[model samples]
Target: MIESTFPILEVADMQRALAFYRDALGGVVVYSYPPDGEGEPVYVSLSTGATSMGIGLTESPLPPGNVMLWFYVDDVDRVTTHLTGHGANVIEGPVDQPWGERTALITDPFGTRLHLAAAISAPPDEE
Candidate 1:
């Protein structure tokens, strides 16, 4: 049985990636393994409430715009604005969906796609 799953993203620059995840997404770096000398971190684990994500340094070409990281936020518009201010490209809008959710799509500086959504209020039942 799978208890939980952690997604690991390979990045070329760890520092830049950290800024995006920590600052933009409001994630905390729970653990990190920096290089032996004065250099960027090779691996880092970020925790956002119950979810955890891993970031690793890679020299090979990274698969940009591949995986999508979906986040359920209290306010989709607010979070999308915050991310855009922090250099995240807005791929789509904060539009209301037929399924009763407001969603927004964005891509971080490291080319990681982020999908932010918030549940819409249910309409009152007609008497």
Candidate 2:
């Protein structure tokens, strides 16, 4: 039975990752191994709305994984701009997709690909 699923990234530095995900992306802290104010954290879970992901400390770098973190924001363009200013590299600016979503692609400071998307407009029923 499928219970729950979430992606966990092994990072060289937990603090730097938290800075990007929690500070820059505005993800709320869901859980931390050391629970803020204790020893350095080896693991952390963060959430942006219903979606959550984990970041764990790694002694050495791991080969890039076949994964892309997807996020739904209220304003793709605005979020893209904000992330770039926070050290994210923009692979593509926000563009409307044929499927009706405005999407942008960027990589975090640690080279984690983030797919930022938003609805181009309200659904037909709402309009």
Candidate 3:
């Protein structure tokens, strides 16, 4: 039996998204396709350790942000700083939640809201 394939956020500016994902989120470019045999790429891929994603340019319309695509990272500060440096707007802070997680919101180039999250510190062990 075959499961269905998933979709990723394909942006018009693939290079910008690639840079943000790699430089900011610490994702590695695992795969890329050249543009008409030229060195330049028309499509790109990035992986956060194990999870992989795709990026490409398309004229299709994109809808608003959905909660399902949120990616939780280990380093919130680094991620926030990197995204902001590359022109992303931080919609919300690295605020601590009562449920024990530090979270933040960022607006991507395509107006997609990305939720950045990290687990809170654990309590010290008893003696």
Q: Where does the lowest 10-residue lDDT sum fall in candidate 2?
A: 118-127
Q: Which lDDT values do the candidates have, in the order given?
A: 0.86, 0.89, 0.73
TM-score of each: 0.85, 0.91, 0.75
Residue range 15-51, candidate 2, lDDT tens digits: 8888889999999988999887899999998888888
Candidate 3 local distance difference test against the native? 0.73
lDDT tens digits by residue: candidate 3, 1-127: 8764434676777767766777766778777787446776667776766577777766665565463346788877777877888777889978887777788898876677888888887644668
- Candidate 1 stretches greater than 4 Å from native: 35-39, 122-127
Model 2 Cα RMSD, Å? Answer: 2.6
Query: lDDT tens string, model 1, 15-43?
Result: 78888888778899888787346566899
Ranking by TM-score: 2, 1, 3
Off by over 4 Å in 2: 122-127
User: By lDDT, who's the top model here?
Assistant: 2
